[model samples]
Target: MAGTVNRVILVGRLGKDPEIKYTPSGMALATFSLATDESRKDSEGNRQQITEWHNIVLWGKQAEIAGEFLRKGKLIYVEGRLQTRSWDDAQSGEKRYRTEVQGNRFVMLGSRAEQGESPESPRASTAQPTRTSPDQPLEEEEDLPF
Candidate 1:
């Protein structure tokens, strides 16, 4: 490999409505939290569902679009790179770090009923998505190297 890849793709529901703000330079900025889920058998052979939370950030027009259309519990697909930023905390005087997905491309997911949109509204709902296409077969556990 000549170069490294730092891409992250997430398909999840918004934990809350996106919050939008403008920079001093008048650029749009949006921030939100997304939740992804996974399920597996525990040591006792009982199934457990786990949810993971991720910080998501969007910029410019994408930020504006996300802020306006994405509501809490809405399903969405975000594609972007992972970034970790560090800052010093004011009260604690300790360095704080945050890892966030700097999403560039966004897509709406799930059916109209799931998104609370009318069946005729295309803007609010979509059939699954690219990576989750039904035509593709899921890889079995044995196929994974780990």
Candidate 2:
């Protein structure tokens, strides 16, 4: 192909509450850990599950929404690009590399058991619609730059 792609899409549960931060420029940045699992039957005919953890980052207005609506163990679908950062620790003088998913869009999958929230609760407004896929027509999405 003449072009390239750096996209990543994941559906998983949050490992912990998201960490929200603000840059000196006043932009919001939210970071969180997500867990994805795989299940299979072992040779002995027993079920086995494997979980993988991922670091996710959301910036600007998206980060703000993630902070407000997402919580620990909440399932979410995220679409983003993979980014790797390498730096040297100031005190340890050791180089480190980290990979993170830089989210462009997100959708809350809702709490599995709804946290005992009633169907008519006011907090239901916090629920949001799912994200758009690449196959969606550009005209139908919010007017945000890609």
Candidate 3:
């Protein structure tokens, strides 16, 4: 009863193209905005639409894949945890707080053709083979000299 969880799952359209940035360490990070909407009948019998915007971030290999495949208006389903960060604006001198989804898993829900991907082609999500080695630990390091 003492455990806590911070998870967020969203299926939405990208508001704009993702921006990829690299740190000094040469790590890849991709940032994008997503929008989700809901429509329902209001008290006046009129349909009302409400939209929520979310900031999404992906790192490492996932970020690279997202940058290459995802685009504006593409519908995607993302499973991630919420993270809040603060930074000082350069010009405004004000503290900026940003909430973002640290995407761990993502699925392209829309048609592959729209993403410049072919339906006949095997995408990364569907192309990868599942791990069958249950007894081996995934984090076990290899003896690479590099």
- Over the stretch 6-124, how does candidate 2's per-residue lDDT look in tens digits? 77889899999899999999878889999999999999999999999999988777777778777898878787778799999999999999999877777776643563334543332
Supply the global lDDT for candidate 1.
Answer: 0.77
Q: If scored against the real structure, what TM-score would every candidate get?
A: 0.79, 0.75, 0.77
* Superior by TM-score: candidate 1 or candidate 2: 1
Root-mean-square deviation of candidate 3: 8.7
Question: Candidate 2, after superposition: displacement of residue 2 in Å?
Answer: 3.3
lDDT of each: 0.77, 0.75, 0.75
TM-score of 1: 0.79
Task: Residues 1-146, candidate 3: write the lDDT tens digits.
Answer: 45767668788999999999997998778899999999999999999999999999887777777788888998887766787899999999999999888776677875676667876643433312112235422333223242
For model 1, where is the 10-residue window of minimal lDDT?
Answer: 124-133
- Number of the predicted model whose lDDT against the real structure is largest: 1
Per-residue lDDT for 51 in model 2? Answer: 97
lDDT of 2: 0.75
Model 1, 113-135: lDDT tens per residue?
77777665546212222222244
